[model samples]
Every structure is written in structure tokens, then in C-alpha cells.
Target: MAKAKWRSVDGIVLLNKPIGLSSNQALQRVRRLFQAAKAGHTGALDPLATGMLPLCLGEATKFSQYLLDADKRYLTCIQLGKRTTTGDREGDILTEESVPSLSDESLESILDGFRGEIEQIPPMYSALKHEGKPLYEYARQGIVIERKRRRVTISNLTLVSRTADTLTLDIQCSKGTYIRTIGEDIGEALGCGAHLHSLHRISTAGYSPENMMTMEEFEAISEQGYEALDAHLLPMDTAVEYFTKVDLPETDTMNMMFGRTIPSPVSLDNGTVVRMFDQGTQRFLGLGQIKGTMLRPFRLVNTSEFSL
Candidate 1:
């Protein structure tokens, strides 16, 4: 029998993506740096935006779905008196309006209108799928389609600063919320149209930008004879840290590795997500769903250790 190729350690990388590069481009660079067989990012950020981008490698990719639903936070600057085709500075200026002079009190009042739940129509220049194709495809052909409004919650919206033509804001919003649209809406409320000039994602879920690393820094260290960068990599179970923990005995662990459900030692009446660990060795088995006394297999991690 031939031996399988051994890959490096598996985990997640919190990349502080630089501006002017797409998310996929950044992912490819990191993948090549690590010589990893598989890698995936939790979400996508636009080329013009920079911030905390979580890149999942190896088994960590299995948990990317959980991070996608997590909340995000951003700081953006919107230029009033101008509207762009792409709702951002990268697009051509389509229309221009006179800047309305307003006091800080007036601006704060307008921001208060967007503090709660609201519906927003996604911009045409997004990666949203329509009829099995991306919306950006239609946009490149100068075609615009009517987008439906999606309900999103804005947990926090504050005017950090304001100038004569640009308004800077700090916002914490739910998943799928668009800061570009919020900039446009704020302009409309203030009687002047606006467009996003700059955006920086400060955090995702609970992961902050302060913990991210730049591509340049990562590349520099790799070139200096560093073999393993796994120290900075977060464990796959880090995403599901909010879930409950369950330890299984040898028999139960063996049954689970064979794709069998077994009784759990802990009694969780309410359905809950749990991280399973081996009782003797304390090794991560995978994630499971607990209901009453039964633990059903959700995602098995030690599949390689067992044969069907």
C-alpha cells in the first residue's frame, strides 16, 4: 500500500486583507504560501474594502458555514453630493447633487432613523445569485434588475465624524447588511445623495481586526526559514466555542466514528450544538447535536481513523 501525502497542520487564518485585492486572490496567495491542499474563506469583502477576513484551511473549512451567519462590524466614509453607478468610489460618477449644510444635531437625528430593523435592496454590483448567475454579470453588461428587499438588523449606528462633504460612521450590523446601501439611504434622508468612498471592516462575529495579519507580514516570515505557521492559526472548534462541550467514552466514540448515534452522558433537554471530545485522550471528535440523552452525529472529524 502507498502512503498518502502528508499535509501541514489545519486551522483558520484571520487575514487583514489589504485594499485593491479581491478576496479570492488573497486566499490563493495564502494557500500557495502554506502549500495546503484545501483552503476556504468564511466570507467575501470587496476589492475596495479592507478588514478581518477569516480564511479556513483543511478541516476548518467545515465550520465556515457557522461564521457566515455571524454579525459584522464596519467603519465607512460616505461622500455626499455625489452618486456613483456602483454605489462606491470605484464606479463612475453618475449624478451629482448640491451638498446640504446641516448641524451635528441634524445629522445625529437622521442617523437615529436607521438604528433598528430595516429592509434594504442590495446593489447591482454585488455577488448575489439570480437564476443561477451572479448579479455582477448583468451589471457589467449595463443591465439593472429589480432586487428584493431583505430584512437586516442594525445593532449600532453612530456618526463618528462629519465634514462638509463626507460623513464617517461606525456601524455594527447583522449578516448580509450592506454599508454602501446605508450610506446611500443616509444621503436620501439628508436630502443629498451619497456614495461609499471608503470602508474598513473592524470585526466579524467576535473576531476583531486587531488579531489579523497582513499578507506581507506572513510572506516575510515564511521566507525567513519558518516551516510551520500553525501557531497563529486558530483551531476549527474555535467557531463553535459558543456551543456546549460533550465528552464521550471509548465505546461511544468508537460507535460515532463508525457513523452510529449513541446515548450521551449529559442530559440536555433543549436541542443544542456540542463539540465532542474523546474521554481518555481529550482529542476532538467533531460536532454533534444533543437532544435529551441522544447525541446525533452532525459532522465527524476523525473519519480517517476509522474504516467503514
Candidate 2:
């Protein structure tokens, strides 16, 4: 018996994650289907949450930073009259409050207060590192730690619908905005606490759930053949599409590969993110940032291959 032949394919796959699966679990399933040598996801979705998780296969992993910083949109459900330890249904119920009878007009008015720039403290049961240890580790041991408030922007937040006990919301926020916290905050403002019951990420930056495929769907295609799976992959440059493109001559390409700062054809000001490409083939070399007139290597892909 011979081992299956694996082709080296590099690109991004917008994954539609289902509830109850961690982000790593979803990435592993995609990796097995593609048989990729290297793969990574731009952001981690909580096991309770679902939708647009971008999986980067092979060289696409190098551009994960760009996707990580992209704004995200989510549709979430909040259950009033409850507070959870983790701020979501997964955590133990910390307390219960009497639900206040409220109208749609009142709910909408309260939600309006959460829009725009605000400060939030990250949940304890999070992956954020604290002195070389994950905060979740301490949270599991029944230890409460003070978390610093970080500024986050909620570009848009609207109360979609409301029932007597539950409310559905649509939110567009900057990176690091936690929907669970928003639910809790809304609860606080209404004079009745709340906790997240259901959360689904509909989009991340430009990647939408409509473009995503579930793990089961991916597996079904993989069982058929690799070509079926390959058809779903987005190009490696998908995440960097917003950056300014700079075509470099072969000499500059060689210099960039060696991590050398070089002059570029474009007159970009300092600190501008730019995508680098080969002059002749227009192959994506890597990413560079402008500092004055010099192009400095911010992130390079396979430097050894392009080295002179």
C-alpha cells in the first residue's frame, strides 16, 4: 500500500464553525481534509459561538496578523434575569435577578448607550495570558484577578428583537470586543442582569458566513477527492487585499528576502502597510511597511526560497 500523495496548496478557507467545537478542532478537521503541511486560524472562536473562522493553509498562515486585526460582526442572544461566572451559558450561574418588564422602545434606548468607543475588562475565563499563565487557569481554581480595562470600539450595535426573557442583538465592533461583556453591560444598564445564551459570529471583516463551509461539509467533500476540497480555498492574498500593493524588481525582491530595507517604486509615507510582489510574475513576496522612503520587511514568506 502507498501513502496518499499530498499537494502543497496555500490559501485561506472561510470556515462556518458549528456550535460546541473549539476553533482548534475546526482547524484540525480542515487540515486533515487538505493534508496541508502547515495551517492556522486567524482568530479563535469560543466553543459556544459559531461562524466565519478563516483557516490559513500553508503560506497563508504568514498573513494571519492582518485578519486578526480586522473588525468582526456577531449576532448574539442574551437571557435576562441571570448572571454567569463566565458571562455565558457555559459558566455556572452566579446570581439571578428579577426581570424588569421592558418595551422595545426602552431596550433600544439602552442598547444605544453601548455604541461607540467604550472600555471593557476581559472575562476571567479567557485565553489572555497573565504572567505566563492563561487567565482561564486561575479562573478554574476559583481565583479572581483584576483585569485592566482596554478601550474597544463598538461601531454599531442594535437590538434586533426582544422577548420577555431573551433579547437578540446585532453588533459590529473592533478587534477584542467581547459580546458576553456587552450582554452583561446591557443587563446592568437595564437594572436587571443578563448572561449570554447563544452567540453566532456572522462575519469577520469581509469574510461572511455565506462563504463559509461547515466541518461536515468539508469532510464530505474530502471523502470524495482533494480536487473537491481545493475548489473551496481562497487565495493566500485574501486577507491582505486592503493593503497597498507594491511591485518590486528582482533586485529588490532579493533584498527583501534577505530582510534588507530597500527603496520601493511607490511614494508611501511612514508606517503604511504594503503588500510586496515580484515584478515579472507578480507573485506575492510578503508584506512590507513604509518608514519614510524605505520599505522595511514586516513579515516575509519563505525568505530562504527568494534569497539571492
Candidate 3:
């Protein structure tokens, strides 16, 4: 067999991750398909959850944190009348209660209570760290750590469908929002315990699940040729489109490349991050911060392989 030859692949690939695989697992598979020299995912998805997992390849890894900080949209199913130890189907049932006879008006009212900014206690069976160890590890050892309530914005919460024992919800929330916790809170509001049955992330930042390719589709695409697989990759700048754009002339651009702050024509508020590009050819240079009247280089791109 020929020795594997890896190449610098720079861009973002939106993956419609199937349930039962961790986000890193999906990223590794995609990285192998592209033979990428570097790769990372924006955020993680539970093994039981499915949908959009953005994989960053090569230079795109530098901007992955922006996607992690972005708002998320999810469609989740909540099973009423049963509370679980881990807040989802993966854990054992803790208790069971009778689901209330709820009307559309009652359900809407309950959902309304959860809308807008709210406080949420992060689940113990989460990836959050405690004393340098993961909270899930402590949870597995029956260690209950006192957790503080955190503020999270739930911009939209709507009832999608309902049955006697199960209700589906569409939620759009800020970073750090816990959907499982919301399901439990919603159940508590209805006088019944609950847990998340299934979850599907529909959107993260500005990317949508509609544009994602599943693992199976990717496997088939990989068989065609490496070029075919590379075609799915979005440019590195795709992750930073929300930032204000600024183009610098050759003199200022060179100054920034050498770690010097230079005068900028853009009048953004001080401390605002902007995407810097070459004024003449429209090539993406890197990122800069507006400090007073000067643009200070923050994170600079390492290669010309990724350009706007």
C-alpha cells in the first residue's frame, strides 16, 4: 500500500452528523477523507444527538471558536412523565408521574414562561469541567457537585408538535444553553417530570443543517476522488463573516504582518474585531482589533492557501 500523503486542507465542512457518534469522531472521519494536516470541530454533540457539526480543516481551525460562541437552534423531543438521572434517555429513570391533560393554550403558556433570558443549571452529566475533571466523571462516581445557575438567552421557544406523552420543541438559544435542562424545566412547569428523548441541531451561527452532508454521503463522495471531497469545503473566512470587513493598503498590511499596529480608515468602535483583507486583490489577510485609531493584529492567517 502507498504511504498516506496528507495535505493542508483549509476550510469548513458542515456535517449532518448521525446519532451515536461524538463530534470528534465525525471530525476525524472527515479529516481522513480529505487527508487534512489539521482539523477541529466548533463544538460537541452528544452521542444520542444528531445534525450539524461544523468541522474545521487546516487554517480554518483558527476561527472555530467564533462558531462555538454563536447561537444554536435545535429541534428536540421531550418525553413527559419520566425523569432520568442524566436528564436524557441515556440515564436510568429516576421517577415517573402522570402527564397533565394539557391544552394548546396551556402548553403555549408553559413555553412562554421559558422564552427570553432565563437562568439554567448546567447538567452534571455534561462535558463541563470541575476541578480539572469532567463533570460527567463525577456524576458517574455519584458525586453531586453544587452547580450555579447561569444566564442564557432563549430567543425563541415554540411548540412544534404534541402527543399524549411526548412534546416536540423548536428552540433558538445563546451559547451555553442546555436543551435537556429546558426539557426538564418544561416538564416541571407542566407538573410532570421529563427527559430529552431525541435532539437535532438545525443551525449554528449562520450555517444550516440543510447544507450539511451525512457521513454516508461523504463516504460515497470520497470514493469518486479527493477533488470531489475537497469540493465540499467552505472557505476559512466563512466562519468569520459576522465580523466587520476592513481592507488595508500594502503599507498598513505589511506593518500589521510584522506585528505593528497601523492607522485604519474604518471607524469601528474601539476593541471591535474585524476581518482584514488586502485592499488591492481582496485577499483575506487575517483578523485585527480596532484600538483607538489603529488596527492591531490579533490572529493572523499562516498561509495564502485560504483567501477570500
Model number with the top lDDT = 3
Per candidate, the number of residue pairs that clash is 0, 0, 0
Cα lDDT listed for each candidate: 0.85, 0.87, 0.89
Per-model TM-score versus the true fold: 0.93, 0.91, 0.95
Model 3, range 129-157, lDDT digits (tens) per residue? Answer: 98999899999999999999999999999
Q: List the residue pairs that clash in candidate 1.
A: none
The TM-score between candidate 1 and the true structure equals 0.93
In model 2, the clashing pairs are none
Worst 10 residues of 3 by lDDT: 299-308
**Model 2 per-residue lDDT tens digits across residues 164-212:** 8899999999999888999999889987789999988898878757788
TM-score order of candidates, best first? 3, 1, 2
lDDT of 1 by residue, 1-308 (tens): 22234365578889999999899999998877776778888888999999889998888888898888898999999999888889999989988889888888878888998988999999898989899888889999999889999999999998898889998999999999989999999988978799999999898879867789999987876664325466678878887778888888888988888778789777786477789888887777789887677888898774575432
Question: Which parts of model 2 are misplaced by more than 4 Å?
Answer: 1-7, 258-260, 303-308
Off by over 4 Å in 3: 1-3, 304-308
Residue 39 lDDT, candidate 1, scale 0-100: 89
lDDT of 3 at 257: 69
Candidate 1 regions exceeding 4 Å error are 1-8, 224-227, 303-308
